[model samples]
Target: MIEFECIQCGTSLRVENRHAGRTAWCRRCKRPVLVPVNATPIADQPDEFPTPVPPAQPVARPYFEPSQPPALEEPQETAMPAPVKRGPIQAMDTDPRNAALLAEIERRGRVIAQLTAEVEALRQAAESRAREGDLLEAELAAARKMALSGVQDTGRERAMIEELNAIISTQRELLVEKDEKIYKLDAALRRATRYSAETDGNTELPDVPRTLEDQTEAGGYEEGAEGGDARANVELDEARRLAQHRSLEIRSLRNALDDMAAKFDRVTVELRNAVLKLTETQQDNERLVSELASARDRLREKEFEGERFSTEPAQAPAESMEPALLEESLSSPVQVEVRPEPVWATAPVPRPEPVRAYSPPVTTPASDMPAQPATDIQHDQRVLVDALLRFLGRR
Candidate 1:
């Protein structure tokens, strides 16, 4: 028997020598291969110990029809080969074709492993890129929202500025109107003060003259204290200017009224001094009227003396006339002359002085006038003159 290895699979086999150098299929690998002719058969060796090999059993081939294996023929055992010249020839290396097949298998295995590792790395890269894309989308959405909010805030600020401008303009107009009102009030107050002062000094209102000049100076202090001190300082300056203007006007009016009253008192004093001169002129006129009445009384006495002379001659009876004629008298008109003195032309005017009257004539018809009657007449003349003087003074 000869023993050999299957070139494709390395499985051991025992075969007859006739099968050497033949092409056959390996039972385990199922691939066709050539057997080497230079191989040493195991049965050809001489051994110090001989071991028997089991017989090979027949195997069925699924690819062919059933057939019987060839029977082995008996042969004499062979002797061992002579000693080798260089040592026993080393066993030949495996078949070149078989070695080539084994190398190709190893190369294929390495290629499969490398391809698997590359596929795993590519899968991890894809997952990382997807996560990054999701994060970028969220950031873009936030930026858009912020831009919209900024635009809304800008529009609101514009509207607020416009409202403030309108309010400021209205305040300016109100200030102008207020200034006009203040000017009108000041002018009216000044006119009233001046007119009152020009009128009769006693006829002015008691409090109004004082208040118009001073109220602005004295009032508003309470309001200033209630408000803040900073604002009060500004208003106080304006109040001071107004008070000064009013005070000056009031002072001028008061001075004018005092001068007019003083001049009127002086004129009244001069008129009172003229009264003594007027009393003397009235006494001289009364004396002239009393002398005229006495002359009329003397003319009656002269007429009675003439009548007695004529009646005594007629009683002698030489120049006899009718006795009835003695009781009658011739009718004749008598002339009396009166001399008049103008009292006003000759009267002397002098400053006020003392006066005294010594005697006064009486015009009443009596045989003799009593001193009591003349005294009464003089007293009555003095009373009449005083009444007339008083009436003139009043006028």
Candidate 2:
């Protein structure tokens, strides 16, 4: 880039290095002047006269702004003034002052022409800048207004996040309380098992032959252990019955506890995921709010700039403002891609197991007790499982 003073009015003008030794109009004086190969504009030097009066600028600018004007080459050096040819008497009659006056008139005319061209350039540039400023202001206003309307959406998002947080907290509390209850129930089950085992151990050995008829009569039934096999003991059969009942009860309780525990775990995991989603939604809302604020600020600043440009013509130069406006584009905030959080159904907790009353131990000798058939034991287990399944189905 190069900068130089216009000799006619002392207005500092700037140009690219390619414009050196070429003629361009002085923005202040409207006179043609030459740019130097290496020069600097003195910012402190004021123009000798006010800028030339501008004619109305071209209103129909193309969609794309035009490039910089071509430089005006030095016309004086290439086309030298022609020599006057006069006859001897006529030349003598011509006044010397008249010749000087004619030359002055020609110089003034060139100056007037240069001033007119410079004025036109300034006018065109000013109009373009004004139009661009108006467009920018419009864009900024529309963008800001759009973002402002989303304030309600942002508030709703925030409220939903808070609501989710509250729900998650309550669920966590319920889970903790339920876990405590489960722990207590487990401890009670263990104690019950130990008590049942101790009661079984304290029983005395039974005399099966003597007590067989008596025990069968006491129960109001006269069935043998294995349907008339003499070796099948009646006392042993009674003990096996009690053991089967206890085993079934224990199995049902354990299964129910396990199912409940698993459900709790699944519920906890789902609640945690919900919390994560809520946190993400909160972050998005915050970002959206920030964007809205910035857009509003930008709109206000642009509105001020537009007002100042429209009102003050002295500060806006046709040449300087054109390049600046060409580089600038209207800015607006882009909204983030937001989505609603989803709710999922979780696994259900099983109902509590029903408690069974403890049975009294039967008096029988372990060495002499008859072994129950595997098939009978399996059949009893299946019946217990079926009962428990039915109970669960109702719930």
Candidate 3:
């Protein structure tokens, strides 16, 4: 006999007949079973065969050789079945297990709903972040364009700074040269002033009578003759006084010129020093500006590196690891102190004293005589008077 077992539950089915082909059902589980023929027996039990039943007789039909016409039958229409009605949901007034399972299902449904909401929120956040990233990318592109423009500007500025420095250096050199020139000019002016003073003092002397006896003897003539001589003598004295006054005026002028020259020399020296100090100030300014530019460049580089690190996720480690140290290092302000150059007070150049114009009196024969001489003295006196008058007029 062939044995068959249920595949799902592993239950054996019993067969009543042992035939070539037999079909049966399992008694434990109400399912159909089929037995295979030519089966092996278990535990030495012989295979049993069932007795065959009699066959049913078939009725005989008359044979005809004629062609028949087929008749068409009317098609029957089947009624459509109604949809099945569902019963109302039962309330939770029954078993605790059912209530618990329903509650668990409801809880799981709520949890699923919450999870779905969280997923939607996360998706929205991701979308927002993507939009923000797009905006940031546009801004970054604009910033990069601006940065390139700034670099060009920086080059221009650097060139300008270099040009300015060159100009300042040239100016400083010119200032030094000017100072030297001023010093030389001052020395030359001082020497010229001293020479002028000496020349003015030694140039000429006034023509004055040498002896008082000449005046007394010339006064001893008759009233009418002495009157004319006395008038002439008075005129000569007035001429001498006028000449002395001129000499005094020339001495005053020389003194004034010397004083002016001395003042000019002192002024020139001061001006030269002022120019030098100004040049130094300009140089200092250039140096400070260069230092400031270097500091700013370093600051810009630091900012660029910081921005680059901030923008890239992979570079975030560098930002986080030493931000304080970097900030502390970068944020310190550079102090540049420019000390003012000292300006020394220049002393006044002393003017040389005015030189007096003096000359030794020369004795004449007429001025030395005690009595009048008789050798055409009137003609000689007339000649002398004419010469004196001419000299006074020329002066």
Error of 1 at 351 (Å): 99
Q: Rank all candidate structures by their lDDT, best first, as comma-separated numbers.
A: 2, 3, 1
Better of 1 and 2 by lDDT: 2
**For model 3, what is the C-alpha lDDT against the true structure?**
0.45
lDDT of 2: 0.46
CA shift at 335, candidate 1, in angstroms? Answer: 99
Query: Please, what's the RMSD in Å of model 3?
Result: 54.7
Which residues of candidate 1, in runs, are more than 4 Å off? Answer: 1-123, 187-395
TM of each candidate vs. truth: 0.23, 0.29, 0.27
- Provide C-alpha RMSD values for all models, in order: 87.3, 44.9, 54.7
Candidate models: Cα lDDT each:
0.42, 0.46, 0.45
Pitting candidate 2 against candidate 3, the one with the higher lDDT is 2
Task: Tell how far residue 268 is off in model 2, in angstroms.
Answer: 20
lDDT string, candidate 2, 167-206, tens digits: 5566557556655655665565555555555644655644
Q: How many steric overlaps does candidate 3 have?
A: 0
Highest TM-score scorer: 2
Taking the tens digit of each residue's C-alpha lDDT, what string does model 3 give over 1-395?
A: 45656554678754534553666666777776666665544533456555589999998999989988798899999999997775332433342323433443444344344333433433343333334335434544554465456556555655655665565566556556655655655555555555545644664533444679755654453354546555555555555565556556556655655665565566556556655554554454344345434434543453454344333321111222244544443343422121221111111111111111112222222222243233221232233334334333432
Error in Å for residue 12 of model 1? 99
Clashing pairs in 3: none
What TM-score does candidate 2 get on C-alpha atoms? 0.29
